[model samples]
Each structure stands twice: as C-alpha cells, then as structure tokens.
Target: MELGLEVAEGPAPYTVLAVKGEVDVYTAPRLREKLVELVSQGKHQIIVDLEGVDFLDSTGLGVLVGGLKRLRSNDGDLSLVCTQSRILKVFEITGLTKVFSIYDSVDGATAS
Candidate 1:
C-alpha cells in the first residue's frame, strides 16, 4: 500500500492527505477515522490527494462522503485531488464528483 499523508500550511488552514494503494472495505474505515480525528482537532479544510491510490470501492467513497458531511457540520469542507480516471469515475458514477470539490493536483487543491 502506498497510502501516506503529508500535512502542511496552506493559504487557508488545510491538510493534504495523500492516499495510496487500494481503498477498500477494510481500509476505508481507517482512513475515515484519520480524517475525522483531524476534523476533531480543528483541521477543517482538507485535500485528499489520491494520485497514489490505484483503486477505490464504494465503501471508500462512503467514507469520504461521511467525512465531508462530518466536516461540513462543523463549517468545514473536503476537497479531492485525483488524477486517476478510474477513481474519478467512481465519484462520477456515484454522483459524488458533484458532491465534493475536485481538483487535478495537490497544488491546485491547496491553492484554490
């Protein structure tokens, strides 16, 4: 699994959570917990960089949606930086491409 994360300061308070490997039913919850913990710690705005993620299942998508709602409840937002067409398709098929802010790169996500 290439899943990893690197958090840095951005224009507005933000976190770049880089996701690698496969995001399936088993790993989705772990990722969700990580995001939830960050939100709980006051890290509201986040950019999930999925360049390294080769695959993502419905469960993974659910985790992201759940996180988005959780953050929004606290006046926060979640954005995604994904390059893979396959992963993007999942978001599109699920109509989540419209639900979450999508970007092409981490720089774009953080800069936007």
Candidate 2:
C-alpha cells in the first residue's frame, strides 16, 4: 500500500506528522515534501509518529535524517514516536537511535 501522511498542530512549537504504510524509495519523497513544507512554514519542532508505519527502508531513513538536519539547522528539533519493535530495530541497527529523540507515545514526544 501507499504511504499515508497526516499533519496536525500540537502544542506550541510542535507539529505532529502521523505516518502509516510502507515508506520506501518511492514514498520517501512524499515524506520529504511534508517535512520540507513544515520547515518552510516555520513549524520546526516536529514529532513524527511512526507507530502506524509497517515498513521502513533506507530511503525512508534518509528522509528522516534530512528532516532532522533541516530542523536542527533552524535551531529546532525533530522527535519520533515509534513503539513497533520492527521499526525501532531499524533505527537501532542503523545507529540512528542516538540521533533521534524517540518516544513511546505521541504525548511523551510532545511533552518533551
């Protein structure tokens, strides 16, 4: 299935992007576009909830890292909410677990 992306305003300074479905090379660009749109709108503090994402590939990781870099350059941060062990393992194995502020829930990510 195709990727599903949803943007929502959270608390001050935090914009939440709820993503579902597979995020592969073909769909990574869509994710990138959403992130770029958010950054362009000056909504940098982002929480990408990947709880619904069933699959994630290297291109997906690249888009996420790119988004994090863009946000950091603007003095903002990009956090992640991913409870699925499969998805978490991707970050862990790639050593990106150290690069992102990962949380168990959206509330936890937004609070911090």
The TM-scores of all predictions, comma-separated, are 0.91, 0.98
RMSD of each: 1.5, 0.6
**Candidate 1 overall Cα lDDT vs. reference?**
0.85
Candidates' lDDT values, in order?
Answer: 0.85, 0.95
TM-score between candidate 2 and the true structure:
0.98
Instruction: Enumerate clash totals for all models, in the order shown.
Output: 0, 0
Per-residue C-alpha lDDT of model 2 across residues 1-112, encoded as one tens digit per residue: 8899999999887899999999999999999999999999999799999999999999999999999999999999999999899999999999999999999998999877
Query: Which candidate has the top score in TM-score?
Result: 2
Which regions of candidate 1 deviate over 4 angstroms? 1-6
Instruction: Look at candidate 1 and give me any clashing residue pairs.
Output: none
Report lDDT (Cα) of residue 12, candidate 2. Answer: 85
